[model samples]
Target: MIDGWYWKFIGVGLIIYSMIVGMLVPLKPSIELVAPSAAKTGQQINLEVTGYNTNYSGSASIRAWLKDEEGNAVLSKNVTVINAQNLVANFDIPGFLPSSDRVVPFTLILDHPVDGAMVSPDAVFITQDSISKVEGQTLWQKDIINDLTLNTAFTFPSMSLIRETIRNTFYHVPLWFAMVIIFGAAVYWSIKYLRNPQSYQYDNRAVGFTSVGILFGILGTVTGALWARFVWGSYWSWDIKQIVTAVALLIYMAYFILRNAIEDDDRKGRVAAVYNIFAFVALIPLIFVVPRMMDSLHPGNGGNPGLGANDLDNSMRMIFYPAIIGWIIIGLWLANVRYRLLDIKYNLMNK
Candidate 1:
């Protein structure tokens, strides 16, 4: 006999822990060079570079160099750090060099007090008019080594479109996961009620779980819309996944309307139980299957992979997994409370 209070405490603790961890971590410094992929001989090339987490406000050294296949440095240039994360580098292409279609690789190196020495190898591509080969050369070694230490605070991944809204992953995604778990439990109790129509307890339990599941589903929709508003530039994108989820929720909504339309206890239990099973069945294809078959903006739709290397990384997985578990526990706690209340009300009515 596990008490409901146990789940309540656990759910609250996990939720709070996830919130703290999801917001505090910092990202490692990364560099992106905006240099041209091709340059002509006797041309002056200027490279624009952007940095993340580079601690650009302080004094930092930035350098770039072009390397040949033989690991010899063909051209070395000093980068002028405009700010912590921004820099400009200039290179002069020699007119005497021969032309080749092959691409030349360049490297960007940043040295910061806070982030230490960050090196981005083969960071840029340049198709120059030079076919001159440097042989018997060795690779250039980094002057500064990185100190791989973890920060105490939690940080979310800084994606291009999502930006800070990536934090919503801890909240929005978990609601749907929790809703699925809660609705699955409702389907189980509905099956139990159908097996023994006389047992009002199963009917009450099914109704309670369904009610809470629907609530979670509605919350999921609202949070998803809020997340979309920031990323997609609208609250609703008419995306296939979004539309299908709305239709599925509406189907579950009809389940409650059907339950209320009935007056007799036994008949109502039998009918609602049947409807609940059908609703869950319909939900499967609408939310999971249909979205995958069509083109959609949502991640994992139309054969697109969910949480790729660029999306959810190892740091995010740390909190995301716990968030799903925490919300599921919380949803169960809500359903259990609702069940007990309905039980008490019905017992009183019998007296």
Candidate 2:
């Protein structure tokens, strides 16, 4: 039986642990902003760098460089650490850009012994009259960027655009995962009820699973919307994933409405069971397959790399995978409680 208090304790404990780890842990040091984003060739430039989770003033051995797609780079002539999270980097722009393009953006890389290395891609664009690759090679290659030390900070990955919202991964993703599993269990019980038409217990269990799954689905949608607002600048962007997920949830909701429409216990159980099974079937394509086929800015969909990529590295996995496990356990426990309540209601109504 899943009624034991021990399982509840374990599930709640893991969930609390996951929440603490997910919220408390910091992201890796990063160059959050580089002001004066453009410069002309042969001009002296001093750009302000606003860093995130960095300690620029703590170390005097700081180095900065601007690099392009090619192997060439221009090292900063002066670096002034204004504070823990702000710095000024000055560079004497080379006479020519290293790239073949007339305009090319350069990445800013900053390294410190205490904070390790942090970068801002396409931080500054330098426009030149010509490519002058050969001449650039002579000028840009003078300062080697090999003196950098690897970052050993224990933190989450600093994803671009996503930034701090990347922490939402632990909650939002795991909730969806748990929802799918709970829905699968609901479908399983529905199948069992269809096989044994005489058992109201299976019907109650199916209802419990469906209700909890719907709750999970709602939470997942809310969390995802909050995450989307950070990266995409809106709560509802009419993205395919959002639309399809809403439709899928609505269809499951109709299942409960269908159950309410029928008053007879045997008939209600049979109809709801059949509808639950069908809803699960529809959910598969709506949530998984259709999202992959369309163009979406949603991470992990439409050929976009999911959490399995660099976004969810070993450090996050410590909180991420455990969160998934904890959510699933809690979902099951909730479903079990819901079914017991339904069973009690069934007995009370008959008595």
Candidate 3:
């Protein structure tokens, strides 16, 4: 038994080793924001920007457009940058004229000079007033408008430690993946217990995996909390992602409570299994469905998908995948140990 457990430990170690090596590989891709932001009514705004190129030289230019709340184009021009190296562009919008309505929007464009190099994100113009007055004079041209053209070379931010930190992606995403797998196992054992009261192993499996899943779930939650606090600020906010995770944890807790409420070992397993299955069903909407529909502070919502093109770069993916596999294997090893202990304690008590 000792040798077998040692081999299992070695296997888990190897999986972790693979994850570390996998995350070290590098990848490069072009990433840029389409625009700075949307506009509202009653506000004057300036666009600002920065760019980075790792390999070669790159230049960027800005274009500006003014639109109504409905996005109908009102006026457009190319900004003349006073200083390209400074990378700043300023534009002025005249106050609402008799014909001009409320809530103006602005869009900025960033163009690149070189083929291989990518331009940084474009800036956006949003106004305070969303409502527009319909009966306004359409002007051929406005005198108050000033377009600024700026030239700026692209620059890359320091990403060496960040590149290696991509392993956290695996750490963040896959422990839940393994948790999903183990929770599924828990449900399976629950169903087996309900059908056959004589089969004690099924009950043992249900408890065993649920415990392991909770342990890893907590780890994933803590790691994610740290990551969010660093990148987003605040350790806990009722963000959709965080809220859903809390719900998932609560549902599992109810499962454990239901188990303890029952006195018969046989009955405890059977009832707990039933609750475990329901918890899995509840997990789907809490973790995946509801968060996607709402405006999330996290990336991947409001027309932005988190970790898509901009957030999790290719360099980060290398380490993340391996960390997931290693953690899941380790989770299973712990589950086995728990399952065997339960089996032994039951046998001795019955004898």
Candidate 4:
């Protein structure tokens, strides 16, 4: 009787694990549309929906839908692809009521029967006029480059892979935020280190977190590069975003070189602290300031428009924001583990 009960408990646990994992993992759908967000009013848009049968050896069909703002159906159709992992369904926007109107918004939906999943519609706005509406208000004076919004959306199966990619959030942008935190901590330690070189613990703590921060910096850069490669064509292009990230990473790399060049540990910490303060300052121009001042292939540019209806839809955000938090926590957790391990290694050596 006890053996049977034990097996039952194990079965229950497996069921729960399967549910959680299912939600986390995302299957990659085929590239349906080349440029779904940049359509102009009255223009024909073709959407191709395709995916693989991850579980079975059979074929799959994808249903497509085009909906208006009021959730009224503009178009709906199903396409079946046989023995093929990917399929493309092409359709055209029938044009809005009046051609005189500048911008039109529509949604694209893809349904996968095998997975019993319906990917919510990806929204897009089309315009030929000079002005655009954000939040239903017209902003006429905004520059065309800055005012444009190109929104796109996709769903993938790897949940943990997706979550780790999300660390690109705090790891990418907020590390600068946390680099500010680490540098600020280093400066505090530097001041203390200068006052009393005898207490080396603060100096070590500063070095530990700074090293971890650099690791995070490298991670953010690599992930950004991968993302850019898929979207922007190349892994390492000389675009404004690429240049800024390179400069920021280079600046931190120089900090390590500067530390190694010095003979005395005390002098190294003090000098490095002074230089670390400059890291954030240099980063500001490269990551934030210059990207805005100059034109960039990246989003959120000064002349380029910010995120909008087309860029991020509700379905993407449902996974995206959680990914950001999960990644940030995971990064911090890794950093903390490294910091503690370093502290232990330092103590044993001194002993």
Candidate 5:
């Protein structure tokens, strides 16, 4: 078995590491087009660009272009840098250019003196004009690559709706992960207690793990509420996941209440162990099944994809996985301390 002090040291080190990496990283420079989504043909449209980390001073060289569905660049325009975070591009839509209601994608290329070259893709320049076949040379080749220099401190992706609050992804999500791990351990001890009713240590350990797991769950819920207040416009949005999680916590809380209501030591241990088993079994469906059955604001539920695909990139995975592991180690340490304290109090009371 690993020494207790070793676990403590590892837990503290990982916690500190996660905090440092999550906060200090600078996001890659990106741009968001702020002009109208649709434009008319044969018109000179002024497009506004809002940038993040795209050091758009007067000295910075910038280029913007619109690519149609067939990978053809119909319009190449010069970018006017307004400030470090803003720019404007003028596009003269050719009358001969074929038009459709479908959105046209664009790209913005910036050469920053300090940050190096950066490219923001999937920008929009839609048109609602008549479609016509116009033969034109593709001004920009698809083979050109713009590689960004990796920052010393890895950065998180800027996403719509989440914005800077994306940083919360590191701290908030891991709490539930840690809670689940601690609770799984509690279930194991509860099963052991049931197998050997004579060993009070198993019962004590079950209680200790359950207490700490519930504490982590409570912290997770509060942090989630705070995250929702910014993203969902309310602290408690009555989301399916939120409601079910609240119900699950209440069920676990009853386990403690049930233990206290029983007076006889042996009887209390036996009953609480059984109840803990039942609560753990119910918790799986409450947290996983019930939430997925309905629409929820939370990810990984109601046909909404979670962390897979583009949501979690490699840079975030580095710190995120470590954060979960670190929190789990700390949670187990807390449970062990609680168990030893309870054991000491029981021995002293008997004397």
Candidate 6:
């Protein structure tokens, strides 16, 4: 049999390692925000650009462009580097955008040999000037967007909207993953106690795991709240998923309340087991099923790519998978400690 401490050591070591790496790994250069999003054609638009993980003043060969969906681009006449994370690019809007619509969105592209290429989609909109005669070729100045350098550096993706908060994936998501596994393990013990109703030890294990699982759920809630404050602009938006998750946790909290209210050992074990099974039954629909059927602010909801899709690329996957495994192990370790303590209490009480 494997030594108990060996597994515990592995759990602690993996968590420490993954946490260090996840926090330390830098994000690739990306545009965080652009001001004055609209400009009329046949005018010069000075864009105030904000960047993440970008070095603006470091390189002299910084180039900028405003590209349309149809592969057409307008080059910036001058790029003024304000600092490391700020810059201003001046674009002379063409007389007419090559589009059917009166207003067209343009993606802002910045290229530096050191920072490589960073793009912010739909950063600015260009509206056609119907009063002026449409002359695209002459207004564009024949400048081409070419020879852009590629970012070969090893860094996490810095996407717009989410930006730096992407780092929360390592903690927020894996906490839920670990919480589910911990609760599932508790359910297993609950089922075992149900099969052999006389065994108080099985009840001990179930309660212990459930206790830590609730703690994990609370932590997940806090982290998720913090993340929401950043991305969704509110700590609690009363999103359907958030509401369901809160309800699920409250149901689990009652498991302990029921156990505490009971006087007899045998009665508590039987009641908690049956309740736990029902609670688990309720958990699935509350967290996963109900949220999908309704509107939710979370990713992968409302026809967006999931956690494993465009958001999490290869680099994130490397840390993300390890973080999941590490967190699961740590949660199990905590559950084991909890059950052992309960075992001690039970032994003392019996004696």
**lDDT tens digits by residue: candidate 2, 128-154:** 986787887788884588778788768
Which runs of model 4 end up more than 4 angstroms from their true locations?
1-188, 191-197, 301-351
lDDT of 1 by residue, 1-351 (tens): 146377778888888888988777666555544555556545677767677666555654444555444443434455576876777767665543322445666554445555554456665565644454331122233232244333333455555556567788888889888988889999999999999887888888899889988998899889889888888789998988789889999999998899889998789999999999999999987887777777777765345523445668778889988999999888888888888888898899889
Error of 3 at 61 (Å): 19
Give the local distance difference test score of model 5.
0.74
Model 6's lDDT to the true fold? 0.84
Tell me, by lDDT, which candidate is best: 2
TM-score of each model, paired residue for residue = 0.78, 0.96, 0.61, 0.53, 0.87, 0.90
lDDT, residue 189, model 5:
89
Q: Write the per-residue lDDT of candidate 5 for residues 1-351, one digit (tens) a residue.
A: 235488788987888888998888877666644565557566777778787766777454565556555555543466687887887778776654443334455554545545555555656555535555532232234434344344343567866667677777788888888888888899898899899988777888999999998998899899999999988999998988788789889999999999989999999999999998898899988886776667777865345423436667888888888889889888989999998888888788779
On lDDT, the stronger of 2 and 4 is 2
Cα error, candidate 3, residue 290 (Å):
2.0
- Model 6 compared with the native: what TM-score? 0.90
* Full-model lDDT for every candidate: 0.72, 0.87, 0.59, 0.52, 0.74, 0.84
lDDT of 6 at 74: 80
- What's the CA error at residue 99 for candidate 1, in Å? 9.2
lDDT value for model 1: 0.72
Could you give the candidate ranking by lDDT, starting with the highest?
2, 6, 5, 1, 3, 4
Clashing pairs in model 6? Answer: none
Mark the regions of model 5 whose C-alpha exceeds 4 Å error after superposition. Answer: 36-38, 68-72, 96-99, 102-125, 133-153, 300-306
Clash pairs of candidate 2?
none
Q: Residue 119 deviation, candidate 2, in Å?
A: 1.0
Local error of candidate 4 at 347, Å? 5.7
List ranges where model 1 is wrong by over 4 Å.
31-42, 57-59, 65-76, 93-155
